[model samples]
Target: MVAPLSAWPWENLGNFKYLLCGPLAVKVFHSWNYEGTIEDHWCLHVLLICALRGLIHQLWSSYGNMLFLTRNRRIIQQGIDFKQIDGEWNWDNFIILQALLASMACLIFPSLNSLPLWNTKGFITLLLLHVAVSEPSYYWFHRFLHESNLFNHYHSLHHSSPVPHPFTAVHATFLEHLVLCIVIGIPMAGSITMGYGSTSMIYGYFAIFDFLRCLGHSNVEVVPHELFNKLPFLRYLLYTPTYHSLHHTQMGTNFCLFMPLFDAMGGTLNSNSWQMHKKISSDSGKNGRVPDFVFLAHVVDITSAMHVPFVFRSFSSVPFSTRIFILPLWPFTFLFMLVMWAWSKAFLLTFYNLRGYLHQTWVIPRFGFQYFLPFAMEGINKRIEDAILRADRIGVKVISLAALNKNEALNGGGTLFVEKHPNLKVRVVHGNTLTAAVILNEIPKDVEEVFLTGATSKLGRAIALHLCRRRVRVLMLTLSTERFQKIQREAPMDCQNYLVQVTKYQAAQNCKTWIVGKWITPRQQNWAPSGTHFHQFVVPPILAFRRDCTYGDLAAMRLPDDVEGLGSCEYTMERGVVHACHAGGVVHQLEGWTHHEVGAIDVDRIDLVWEAAMKHGLRPVSSG
Candidate 1:
């Protein structure tokens, strides 16, 4: 299928400077019968254009992310919590898909041989027609997918990115991709049918096509509402980044592709979507800066998602018409309240900046931290994905999960999240390495033997092993001897003498100190005896956090002034109690160390103290 240089679409397509830059070697011959021109310079030309589009998209997405991470308000600009985002990417999305699909389209469709690229009215109408027809088609198609069971099977993967990115726009099912291809093909097919063929038009249409898709999925809002307000119909012409972001967050609303008209007419547009758009847009330009690292937290539900305000608890027992007024309407009222609560959460939700006592900032990537807990446990995987996605969207360089987030995410410590979202640009930290350093370093010099709880758990095992290695006596406790025996079997022989056991912590009067593990919190045991010291690895805000029976028994512990950024607050919005698991995660990410010791459960894997501090971009506490 070799064609002479004179027969090629070259001059008819007018001039594209980029295409002209490459070599014109028509000396090559083709042998594939009909699959386009295999060895032709035209194929090389098409592949180059696809490559150019990809490079542009990557740059665009990265620049937008830079604005989100460094320009916007750390907390408030980050729409959803970090865990609410689902994240995954691969080379196929970055290059292979675009190139393969574009090449296939080039061979099958009436492309470069058509007309010159610059028919202002012709190609513009083609792009608009593509959007116009694709909008309703996509809306109904997408909404139907969600309303039906097809979501979990196929559509769910695209929805997985609750915080969308340009690359994420094409990350969909094969069927969805086919539908999208047809939707895009509609205008091109129409143009050819209407007797309008231009190589420039086809290339122009696709470049615009990929650009719009990428813009819609970007983290930064490129089209502000002010533009819509000024022009009015522009809203029908353009969809901002926030517009698509809302679709991902609400999931049940904003289903249109290129514009909001379809969603508005269909009544699925979220009520608060506009307000969120305004808020995020207002934080643009000079107001859009963020830091290198910030704590992104979740709104953390201490109660049920379907629950009413706790202040209304006493109202349940009230006698207002008592049974007459409250009893009958209770079910109806409950439904109404549930609807309103969900509405408010959906529309009004905003992440806040969590400031430390030292004025350092932490980004709350989510509204509530409990998305992975209680009845919502079924969707823990999706919730975790959403959080990471949101963090990446806001340009958060590093994020640390708190409380239940850590519980569900730290299976292999931070390895689970790292493995799940390997392509995410932002760093995922457990924040445990620093916590371990603080607790271990504070092992009071006078103490000879230390009492430890939950020896079988990850944190407990690590602490016990580290203590034993340091030649400090560790009184390990467990519900049964089986786990203890396992630990004994795995321990180095010389370390056995440093490990002991006690039937009850109350009876260990000889050891006034204790190291409380996360697992121990749920055990409901009294690890805190009167006149004792506790090194708590779990956040103090946890409801299960226990206090010594003798009010003044447990001693107060503080992070050395150097790492004052870490520790719990008792009065001024208590934040930062060192959790060994979270600390270890921070260390692993900061040091760029590869420690998959989660299964092995070893504290030695944690690089704490001065070494961690040196790399943390913060000064160490005065060496005293």
Candidate 2:
């Protein structure tokens, strides 16, 4: 009834194909059109259905199948051929099996996704469960396979690539993949099935699972550790590139696939993950050790060790002038430093000498600011003098004040008076007492400028205050420590806005003696008061002075070989009695002089006497 089978549209076409083809084509043609219209449509629909099915089968077999084919080159090559068939039950097959099971659970219990227990709870609890169940099971099994006895047969293929690429994720033994999949799948399926809920939630959960699984296998370096780790919940969810790459390089460690928390807690986590991040952050190009604060500390320690000996050796050679001037070119700061160092050096030298025992046992003790004091004072004095000279050159009135004793004056009566000049003036002041009242009464009101010399008495302090109150600029020159201390104490509060103080010390060994006068000693002097030979100890000057006197009077004074015929001289003839000598005395006449004066003898023949004394082992007496 369907119109002769050969005459119908489908039948005509089939008969024509059968007539022109071989027996196999004939068989296919006959099998293709065996029924009527309803049957034909059904047959056509089935053929169409089979064609669609073939397309999907090709995609799965070719594309999807390559993921598993990663294990062996021959297998992958064989997989490309449509006709060639090879079967191997690899780990990837097992994972697929487990994934199918999980997919089935989702399909069967779609409502599990909407269940309040699964949908409403915090993400942390879910993440914890994911890690607690999956990582330990995988880690223990992985470790078992890596044992010496089993590794060759069961684990060698997995590590063949050394650094597993994305494709390599699926390359494993059948049993191994099966075990991993089941371990991961059972918990996931159970969680979803037991917590069944709405369809939308179920779909959402699967979507998320698929997305994450694909991301885990991807090779992109997109995520940052700070973003991943800092999040309280997501830290367990995301696996950064550092995390997965470490797993590939360091087998058996970093076993958790989805979460890092499990590996960290189980002590199986590779520290290389975090370390790599740190290295990258530091911009270290190679796998070199990271340079941290601790590294810097080590460098400092080594540097200090290498240079310490040299630093100590050269310390004494540095001059006081260099120390003082170079250390503090900083403004106003050097003032406090200069004062402190001078005070300390003076104290140390005094204490050492007074103890009466020294053989240059040690170098001088240096303190903060102490090193710079001598030179700083020089620089400050120079700057002050330069200012004064410039003012003098510009025709500004320059005033000078000197304190004098009333009895020594050339005039018959004593009086505080000022000396006048075309552009400068000098003043001599005599105080009845070292009190503020005498100073106030004696200082002239007309004097807009003043200079105080020999200002080592209480009278100097009084005079300083009186001049300060009168709005006069004052410069104080003194040698007394007590007076220096007093002026320093009061000058800050007193109205003396422009007060300058200067003091000086006599050098003791090849050193300058400024301030009052130079104490010249004959070169024959042997020992210092401390019992140390004169050549053994070095004493730096602790004082300040004007530019002219600093170099000319103090620094330039050379020691002479003899005191005889030089000028009027006082000496101790013996340790017991003092004697006087003048330029008229012959060098040979001073035989009775004490060992101290004997040591001071300037005669060229004195060496013979010293040699004789040494032969007799006579101790020098009253060394000055």
Candidate 3:
């Protein structure tokens, strides 16, 4: 059944919904420019209050989803899915609507515009009115909405989230929010019409209302159990997060707005609310689950820094790209980046479940540019080593070094950690074995000769060695003959002839297949024939200079269909797809391999890793 109030007029506006305030903004600026009375400046206060409300909600969300602080006490252990994210993306829309309504009220009522900054009597009146009127009204109206017809048509939209985030507080149908506006506005309206209202009373009441709503739905229990035990009656007066969580989980009970006193009075309080609150609040370190696998990665750039799950849920759910709205946040994010570079250590970013095992992603405090700095190498490797040791101490099954975390020049592809700490129980993996397999499998079976760049690097060596075994000719590009001969000698006696050294890009002019493990300029890419597809394992993938030739993405794999609770994308890869190395670490944990898959990749296991990944439902991402 479609509800009459299910759709909003600005629902289709997306980020453009902010433009609805444009007229008020212009009016406020014009009034200020002309030195108009406080009555003419009243819209400024409404707009300021709206902006503060939005900030409060955003802070609550970021703090709630920071698992490092709240994971143990979190009432809901599951990740927030994309559907809930999209539904709640515009949670602040009501703030703008309320601002407009307030503006209209100011124009109609001359007294509301000339209110004093503070009034002790008005503040007391607001509190009493909230208790006598707003509380009871909301308790019964909420119960009415829960009735079958109303719940199905409108209220179900809010209850659809199995896990309640801070934004979930405002996630409701237009009718539901319109009712909420009245319930909230009554006390402030009563104080104003009674001639006792002030600027602070309106601002103070709205702030408290927004704060309490966010607190109830935060899903992280922060109310100390001792406080309730000491006071005994505070539980009825102040509803904890656990109390509201029960309403979402067991919908028939605990239907009060912010206080459980109304629920007790209505005989709708859940019997288990107090018990659940105490349990979640008392939980600590020993009760937490250690992750099965940890993918240790670092921020790639300034834009990628905002791609964490808590920053912007909708943006983080899909592949990352710089958007116009994100530009406003650049200054703050840049300062955060500098602080992380100077003082931060490895920290948890986000997590998901894979076949009942917990997998988490952790961020190294350094950025991609710092890895190439001569002085920063020691610092970067120290961070990786410390992370590996910490994972071993915590019983983590496998820890994978991502991107530049495994750079050979920096840490020898995670070998330094394994060698330095030989007694460690956790398996350290660079995950390049499967990376090689993914790149090799992309080539057509009939292709005879291919041009290879970065031919002597780790992946380049493995790819060349594997292809030569299939009797495919490889024109290995490198200026150093010694490094080329070293990789060539590793190949079998008969296949050694299949590996040929070339010092220049022009040598590959006739070759139609190009395998690039290193960056290539447009001048170098132009050497390939018209239809030569570029298959690369390069970081910050090479530019697509030629429209005539296709460019392959960095080797990646789609997670198994059964993967659960995956809510965020991995860097630029689409949802459910991850870099090949990250997938390799997952394969290691799934297969229960005892050996650490670090250092140089074993060319012999290229096919073995591929088969194991396939057996476990990991599909190679299409190069196209």
Candidate 4:
């Protein structure tokens, strides 16, 4: 199985691959600072050109993956997995290598060093060379790579992504990319050698090259049908996204790089290309398919704004954490937050399929801190209500409120929406019913007594009532005796004694099991006994203060193995695991439950929801 091509030498460097061009960049800058003019500086021009290439790729990646803008027009219905994301992480590595090579070429050749800033003649020569030599050569070379051994080693890497992303255009083996450098260089080298080369022409050509490359792999149908119909020859001259996508999926056909004329000449053109293009582009209209469930979520922090699927695919695929690269993007993200606060609406984030049903995540355009602002409450509630009503209009069967979207202080856990629109079809769910079930189930069945914090909140209240029914002692911690008595009154008279109201952390020192529904600092955590295990349903999970005492994650559930296209993790949760509330919504849709689960967590439905989740293959995440 050993093949001709191998990995790039800098492949192991990860983010440090950019460092490969450091020496050359320093040389170019030093020369530019000393020299009077940069018009004849080949190295500096090469560096700037390479930087533009990377920028172009990044712009397309971000724009193409924005689900709210491009979901319906997406050529591929399938989702990208973690493996594809990892492979494409260093897609811009080739640009760095190109810069290094071009610098070396400048050093080797005296003629390439003195190119002018503009040359109409050189631009024409470059275009002719690209059309006459580069086009046909790349066509056959690309076709040759599909041959047995070459395909197995070199070409398959590029074809690995079934749903082609913008970066997928350059995600290839080192040897394959080396050949690509030659294909691109022929035009530039040829124009310069003939004394017709210019700096502007080089910039112009590479920009077009990158733009076309990104366009082909963007996975969204952007080219209109009327243009091709009005000028039919453009079909063979220019390849669309649907055209390139067929090559990745079918492999044998559409061997041309940017032009499909070679495919037509080689008798490899798929007849269905234009028809498929029309269908996909038309589908991007208002008649597109509607999802069955939508999980409405909001950004948690400034860093979290970039932890979305569209921002950076690889970063979003795993558990979200602040990274060094993301630090540089903070200012841009902060500005975006301000814009969202002023003019944003609920937008699509990501989506996946489960049991033939479409489920999507929609983002509320506000940060977590904004939800805590008293002045923003009305605006936040209006956004949530608008999203709910929109989902109802779209025929969504279930729409789940996530985190602060369902805050009791603002909208009574989605009760206000349901009450206002009593006849709405889409079931509005706060999902705390299953949130309580997940936290309660994490407790060992044999445990008799447990300390509970935020004991009067919706989830805490449900847990207290459910545990008391099982003859377990519930040490409810809250300062409001009136709220505690109100919750306790709901329990049966015989089981009311089990729900004890304790006002201090000292009351829990004797208890080995702690259910944390609110944030607890290290000082408060010290009150727990040495072996006390903390089970929390808190956001931004409390720090692990007690090394001796284990702490459980925020209640989450591992999706069923049958779940498809689940590429990104939910916040800090690991891949394939989502918060228990999101799982609750899925379970609601699967069980065909018509009732809206809002306001209070129904104590009676705790076991019923848990069993239904288990029946449908949703398993509780381990408490650690």
Candidate 5:
């Protein structure tokens, strides 16, 4: 019963490693021994393969059923009355049928198992024939299952979860899996028999295919888009996450398991699948949303790119005389357009301010006349002062003027002069000393003080002269280091005794007592005094006087007081303790006083100060 050594491929121990590890390993493993045979090796391999398949099928099916049960329980507890169980089936009946078929194939046909067909040229032909028919055949039939009615009946059960987990792959009904396998397997089996095939090649092919199919179904995002897109030719040779994820969303598209070429050609490829892929990738931190600036830049770039035609069309549309007229006037036209646009923006801002302050709503249409002529009426100053006083009662201490540069009456320093202070019964005079004198002469005798900010400048100094002549106690607060030095140089020595440099923060703390005046410098340095003793009054814009005096003359001058208990008798004393405690600079406290004491404070003014502080990079509380 001893067969020749040639009959057994592994009898040669010298080639053992080659036989086990080489391409022929599958062939050697599947070879059957006819003489004194210990059963055909092919039967052992088939049994092992079927057992592994059954084990995987059982595990996945059990897990999927558990998931279904949990979801059903949640639905019932939520008071939902209806539920659908679409893919439930009898697994035992399907297993019995499969067992019977396998028994008939293996036990009844022993001759089929004994073929020498595995070693011959027939094996090569059979392998090629099987792969060629199996791949396309499976693709087409799978596509048919995705048709509307068919998907609802069978395929939708598989797509119930948009994000398919590992268990979902084998979670379909037994009948569905069986139908798919038979549809694919029948063509493959027929090709093998028709080509005089061996069982080893067929088994090897199935093992590789199934392993890849398992990988495709696994919830792993390993493959990259660039590589996937690059392999246009071999793209059909494998299944990707993109392909499977799309199948879960738009169930009808991308029906093939291994090949995508069929789906692409059939016009069933989901257009939005790539967007979903990008979203998933971004959610996983692989990509991110586009920045707003970059998006805006792209829009601008596109618009600019399209503007060339419009420019060319404009040149072609005009007559010769019209073209000549336009060519010379276009620059001025552009300038005029710019001016108008600027005016429009200012008008809108002023309208927004009036609407916000008066109506507590931004109803621009209701205040059309005010917007068109911002400072047209004469009594607006009185009304504004009344409004400011009402606002001060509510603890608001700033007023904003939404004056555009184009408004003639409100332009430059005139804007400040138009603001009325009811508490002082005076109108503010802005500009250098000359304009201040003119405004001062116009003020009624009842006005007591003229608060002058920006007094460090030549204009502010001149205004101070006029206020002094009028016997007004002119308080000038300043932030400018150079201007402060200049004011010391230019100011009459006797006039210096009346000047007080206090910060806004100190002013607020001492709001119970003293009134603050206009700031002469920038707001960086603190100058206001704090405590409960003094009632504060802010300088009204205009100061009235009964008589005029020279710049060097003392107009109703008073000597400085020498209080023994006070820390410093000198008016210009620099105390670190006072400076550190006062946060609001001299300018803000002075401006706050004008609005606070004059009763000109409004919500709009407070909002403006808040916004301005923020714009200048100050950390103020947001009001709106």
Candidate 6:
């Protein structure tokens, strides 16, 4: 005896039960039999529904950020801007392409196997399974991406943003998106094919998946501490916004999507993740206090394995001929690298705050190489921008572009940062002015004349002008006298009269003071003239001949008196030297300039520069 169509719903579709499944069962049931041809009738309708879901998600994401930022900016993670999307490639097109592909995939998935319209479970069960499986699958796949060669070639795009947003959740490669479908799709498709899911379950799957993706990428944090410690099992099943944001900021931690079970078991949990989450969630964002300026150092290289760990970095630091000796221990070295990566990933804090009485300073990991290399470094600007954007989100008042970081930035001197983000609250400074100020302060008062190298350089020009203003005759040294002298002649009268342009370093031998305005490292202690009080602005002082006679930095200029409530910090063996740009950042924040300062080193602005230096506790040149 054959069963009727209505009877089939109760008999064939059994076990799981849900009230929401009624509409889905009816829709699919009627379409398969009563409609004669399901394709002609429901294709456009399904497409329309998919488009609406996409539109709704985008609108809701924007609305959510504004609502939260208005009520409390603290709860928000990366804010509303999409810095990661502002690259060479068009993201909107890619996002649209992905959505269309996903919709197409959805249409194709159901047709492959006729599913039993079973109302197996409610919306709650659907939510639980996606979270439980999504993160574990995401955990292993993401780990593979970072650990393999694909990191630089492809995965770097998704990791570009230090802070994630809802739009960024889908900002991945087409291949990656397809792989994601397989990773996230197979489980759901299996359950439905086995007569466990109804029409509502499929809808529930997409709705929950999209939401958690946005929630994982969003700046908001709703998972409280009590949920984790009070109910430990929940820790295995839930993930907070703070969890994923950290993965973006500091790579190699919190890789799971909605669960921490895999990450904890895999030894990739960030120790400071919870504390940072608490800080972000608890902030009132109303206190009018001076925020810290975060600085990230340049990494040694972008195209090499040096960014991973000390071992990997050290291994690549050597010559290839010498590197061959260590090749025999590849297996052992790999194991070591894995152990170190796990320990560091689990416990290390990549950022630190150097606090003073008046203000605070933050420093992040090195993104580029340790020293300046002649090779072309691609994708570095984006990395630096990510750090700057991260700093902006945390409310950094000023960002100091340090060392080679200044030269590597967009058009150098942070012009790219300020131009790209006109309304950005975090101020960008090259620290050139304050550096010039420190170098200028090192000049001996008794000298009648001084020799300035790199006279065409911004720092060189500033120092020359300061010397001329002080009535000290300036001898400008450059590689080309004809071209530079013509350029130098255009300066104000007060500067031209006291300046003499030459094209040789030997001209400075007669002068009592020699300031290497360029980034020249010293090779020999007696390289300078015997009595010459030579000051070097380039770091890692080539020669520390004498504290007062041959100073090696502009940032650590010792002041006679302390400003604000901080102590006077002179260039010493114990305290260490501060970068001129970093010191300048302290000054810029205290001075509170009216306009943006790309690299301010004007002679007129020298007065406050000195005060700003003193406030940061940098003492003037002291003879040890």
RMSD of each: 23.0, 37.8, 1.7, 2.1, 29.7, 20.5
Sorted on TM-score, best first, the list reads 3, 4, 6, 1, 5, 2
Best by lDDT: 3
Which clashing pairs does model 3 show?
none
Q: Write the per-residue lDDT of candidate 5 for residues 1-624, one digit (tens) a residue.
A: 432221223323532423232322243344543344435554454555555554454433333223112221111111100011112212222333343354456566565566554645555665455456665666677777677876666666666543343334554544466675574466446654665556655555555555455445544433454554576566555566556766765676777766666677678777765555444434443222211100000001111211111122122112112333245545654464345334332111100011112101000111213433545433333333343343343333333321221123433333433443335322222212212222333334554554444554434455555445445555555666566555555546666544444333433332222222232222311232222111111111122121221111101111112101111111111211111001122113323335221111221233344333234332311101
TM-score of each: 0.43, 0.28, 0.97, 0.96, 0.33, 0.44
Model 3 agreement with the true structure over 194-283: per-residue lDDT tens digits: 889999998889889999999999998999988999998999999999999999999999999998999999999999999999888888
TM-score quality measure for candidate 5: 0.33
Most TM-score-accurate candidate:
3
Q: Report the lDDT of model 4 for residue 144.
A: 95
Model 4 poorest 10 in a row by lDDT? 35-44
RMSD of 6: 20.5
- Put the candidates in lDDT order, highest first: 3, 4, 6, 1, 5, 2
Off by over 4 Å in 4: 28-41
Cα displacement (angstroms), candidate 1, residue 119, comes to 3.5
Model 5 residue runs over 4 Å out of place are: 1-43, 54-100, 115-132, 272-624
Expressed as tens digits, the lDDT of each residue in 428-458 for candidate 1 is 6655545455556667666788877656666
The TM-score that candidate 2 achieves is: 0.28
Give per-candidate clash totals.
Answer: 56, 12, 0, 0, 32, 16
Q: Looking at candidate 1, what is the lDDT of residue 51? A: 69
**Residue 569, model 1, lDDT:** 30
After TM-score superposition, the amount by which residue 92's alpha carbon in candidate 1 deviates from its true location, in angstroms, is: 3.5
| Every candidate's lDDT | 0.53, 0.34, 0.90, 0.89, 0.37, 0.56
Clash tally for model 3? 0
